[model samples]
Target: MAGSSHYIMPRAEFDDAPKLLIVISPYYKDIADNLLAGAKAEIEAAGGTHEVIEVPGALEIPTAIGIAERMSNFDGYVALGCVIRGETTHYETVCNDSSRAIQLLGLQGLCIGNGILTVETQKQAEVRADVNDQNKGGGAAAAALHLIALARKWSVARKGVGFTNDILMAGKTDGSSTA
Candidate 1:
């Protein structure tokens, strides 16, 4: 029996379709391909657009996103990768550090969905990445879309006191204007 039931969120509609960047670590190319398929499907279904870039490994995913944030025009980011637990403690370091970095970036007010799978075995990753199964890649893309919607909802171009031309001119002369 499956450990869980299928669950999917309602489809989202957007006024201003988001332009997204998908940063994937092609450490496992096959898994990455599956992930990309799912992510692309979700992005297209939502009427959003995305571009994919690959880094060497999971460790580089966040750094790539950070760089893209400063250098690219994407409204949101989807981080996709898989890190199968290994015999060495390196797995933990990679898992923890990458996840932490992604979270930190999100807290910095970037829209990001982290889809790095830190699993005990390849089988686990396959199950999660399967399009008919967990479909974590699509979920991550959906997550980014939701966050982008929220960001658009609460976006602040500017927030402060306002003044008309007359008020500004009068204030410049008298240094006080109730207008």
Candidate 2:
């Protein structure tokens, strides 16, 4: 006789333990507002405090994030904006530069969430900005939380802390266990 094996999933328990900063562009007011609201709700649900900062436009998100990262007060950041393709190549430049800067911030161990929506038309942007559904804002906050969780985990692991029960127990006695 054999019994089925059961497995447990590890849950990220970062509730009420982190702070987040959200930067929004005023270029597309309506869409930006929706994104901000969604991101704020998600951050609060995750047990985190959040603050919103308005930038001139999507092009300024990276700079704002950079300043936030340098401050090191918040654990993570979420950038919200809407960039719709127009008659020129301005869209490409904004999208690429903002993305690159965010990535760079992440590489430097800063948890940055990108909520900027790049679309071909206003309609497409509207669909994603809908607060009822398809909310990119929530997605960005989730991303920030995820990155912070991973960074914390990695930091602990680097210090020779294992996720195993035995190691955790030993660490507890040594006051070196984190979780």
Candidate 3:
């Protein structure tokens, strides 16, 4: 798959495989299942283990991941869902808010892959979710894995600037020695 035309980056490899959390919304049950299949297969291929959790709908997916990031120790997250347009404006709200939330969480140093599909028709969603087609789910999983690898690479960052006077005693706000 080495082609300059595609310009795809090489897959990230890890010595210590990371654990991942998949937060999916099953509002569109069949579509969600297909997405999950692709995502799980991709995570497995990357030598990573994952836990899947279903949110009520697309709007809840990012919220669930945010909770997991605070309360759990998952190395990364994959977000999957399908938002098919309807007659109401609710579709836009769900699509925009969920995506914005996911992006915000990623900015907060959480490795996340956003796979929520917002489409005008079920046909569009199906094509994107299909494993043998666009395989957006698998693409999302791959993105998360790559981010995790990058996180691991930078986990050793040290920005400390201190000396003897900067050392603080236990429970002390000021940099003062108890002795």
Candidate 4:
């Protein structure tokens, strides 16, 4: 049942080419490599350029993206990592906190694709990270590209910051009543 289901991903197109920052936590070197390969392929397929950065662990991925958003000019971000369940509750903490932070950042209007894999074992993570199989990294990139396209589509040019010309012409700039 794993590979039986399919999702209809939105077509990732943009009027202007987008630049994406891929932040990865490479605790598992092989899995990270596969995820990065898939993400790169997807971004390139959509005519977008990307830069990859490595963080220490899954918990750091969101922080890296947040810093990049404030300091750099990337149009979007892709977060990639794998957290396998262990004997202790550290796995739960990492998975929950990392995912929550990513979600909060997304809510703040950042075009972010979350590719972090939380699984019971390394085998499960391998299957999901494999480009030939689930290709979650590619899926995440596509998701980010879609968001960027949407933002571009709905974006409107700002004429000015203050009130409109009509409001100014009315001579009612302040809340005080003339009467």
Top-lDDT structure, candidate number:
4
Please provide, for model 1 over 1-179, each residue's C-alpha lDDT reduced to its tens digit, 9 standing for 90 to 100: 65767667786679878999999998998899888888999999999999999999999999999999999899999999999988899999999999999999999999998889899999999988988888999999999998998888766543333755665666376666565
When 1 and 3 are scored with lDDT, the better candidate is 3
Off by over 4 Å in 1: 1-3, 156-179
Ranking by lDDT: 4, 3, 1, 2
| Alpha carbon lDDT of each predicted model | 0.90, 0.83, 0.91, 0.91
Cα lDDT of model 1 overall? Answer: 0.90
Clashes in model 2: which pairs? 16-47
Candidate 3 vs. true structure, TM-score: 0.85
Per-residue lDDT for 36-88 in model 3, tens only? 99999999988999999998999999899999999999999999999999999
Tell me how far the alpha carbon of residue 46 in candidate 2 is from the true structure, in angstroms, after superposition: 0.7
Cα miss at 31, model 4 (Å)?
0.3
TM-scores of the candidates in the order shown? 0.85, 0.79, 0.85, 0.86
Give the Å error, residue 71, model 3: 0.9
The weakest ten consecutive residues by lDDT in model 1 span 156-165
Per-residue alpha-carbon lDDT of candidate 2 for residues 66-177, written as tens digits (9 for 90 to 100) = 8877776988899899999999989899999888888988898889889999999988888887878678898888788888788877776777554666665763766564
Clashes of each: 0, 1, 0, 0
Stretches of candidate 4 off by over 4 Å are 157-179
